[model samples]
Target chain A: MKHLYPIKESKQCELRKASPETIRFLLDYSKSLKIVSSRGLTFESNLN
Target chain B: MELHVDDASLVKNYLNGDEKALECLIARHNQRIFNFIYSKVFDTEITEDLFQETFIKVIRTLKLGKYNEEGKFLPWVMRIAHNLVMDHYRKNNRMPRYEGSEQFHVFAILEDDGVNAEKRLIRDQIESDLGVLVDRLPGEQREVVRMRMYQNMSFKEIAERTGVSINTALGRMRYALINLRKFIEENQIVLTD
Candidate 1:
């Protein structure tokens, strides 16, 4: 089976193992593309 | 024998009013096109609409003799989707942002558990944690992951789209994976196999 989670074979393991706090921090960084996409007045998919 | 033709040839045939050729082309590329659009917007419904729109634009532009057959057909369609995504951002005057630092909070958009709130909460927590790590990556790395993993773009296509060397694109992916791995380890989160 093709592995979706192929561990990176690199020396920079420290950055790879982000703390839960750090993970939460990053999610907060980028705002929602949905809101932006919607506000742009483009066609929204009704399939959702 | 099923007449085999390259994408360009098929496109040209479609341009010449061979309607079946267009159908063949759509069958060949729809899933890839859908994945590409989904990666950019991160919404299944939006991706479906954009997927349809991408093909419509392809048909319209091809009929108008606006596309250059010098490049592969999928890339041209991808360019259309990319432009649409960019236009979306530009018109809204907003940036793509997610909340939290550790996991992906975007999963909240997927959950609705009146009876299983606890399960939903746990899943959301994990996603939020992972989302944070992914978000902290450098811009180039993040873009590469978005294209490669989310958009399902090939290294060649990504290089072409971003106007970067293929090696550079691959290197960005490599670094992105490395950083993500580190982020996971430091957080002591076990991703299920």
Candidate 2:
């Protein structure tokens, strides 16, 4: 359902016009976020 | 394939000992929470601590069955982040003032192509925060805001891409600004000197 939202224009979200400070902050924030978010991302089928 | 769970499912799975499920939940919304915190405090290290502390509080609440899922997990988590940032400020005797100090016009930064690299780099963090907030706007409104503000597109171009009339596109833009202003004010998102 979430992905069903017409994503044709979604490519636009990837277009970031960030400066070095923002780039640094985003890199750090995203790194930690990805680390935490990936916790159950590759789970075994029977885990549920 | 059949069990592509959502945030709520991941959260439930976490409560049931699927530790990874909680990870997925954090992964999904951590940036949003981080964006909110970073915008308020404008400090990366403090933002990281608040991010972890926010999740700690969230995990504790979930373990105690205090999480009532009303289908808005991210915003709830963001509110927690917002509160924690505020609490830290209060404890430390510092609070974010609104535009009273000075406003860093995000749009001006984009429009003026001749800006110095040093200033651009400095303002980039705030721009990133502003971008995150704009993205939080609902679907069409978000689309319009991005096209108009970030992309620097004319209203006509926005209307064409969005398949709306000029007036409709204008309406969305208007509403987007109104909502963005309200969100910034309510959240106390500040701009520095």
* Predicted model with the maximum DockQ: 2
**Cα-based TM-score, every candidate:** 0.38, 0.39
User: What is the TM-score of candidate 2?
Assistant: 0.39
List candidate 1 stretches off by more than 4 Å.
Answer: A1-48, B1-3, B94-193
lDDT digits (tens) for residues A1-46 of candidate 2 = 8678667768845422223453344334323331122454532121
Q: What DockQ do the predictions score, one after another?
A: 0.01, 0.02
lDDT of 2 by residue, B37-127 (tens): 8778776778877877787667666655668965677878888888998799997776554333256754544465676887777688778
For residues B1-193, write the lDDT of model 1, one tens digit per residue: 2247778788777666676776666656666766677667776666665665566566556654568855478888889988887887686576765565455567757666564877677877867776778789999999888888768999999999999999999999999999999988887887552
TM-score of chain B of each: 0.46, 0.46
Overall local distance difference test of candidate 1: 0.67
Tens-place lDDT per residue, model 1, A1-48, is: 347545664343322121334223222221111111355454423222
Of the candidates shown, which would achieve the greatest lDDT relative to the real structure?
2
Error of 2 at B89 (Å): 1.3
In the order shown, the chain A TM-scores of the predictions are 0.29, 0.32
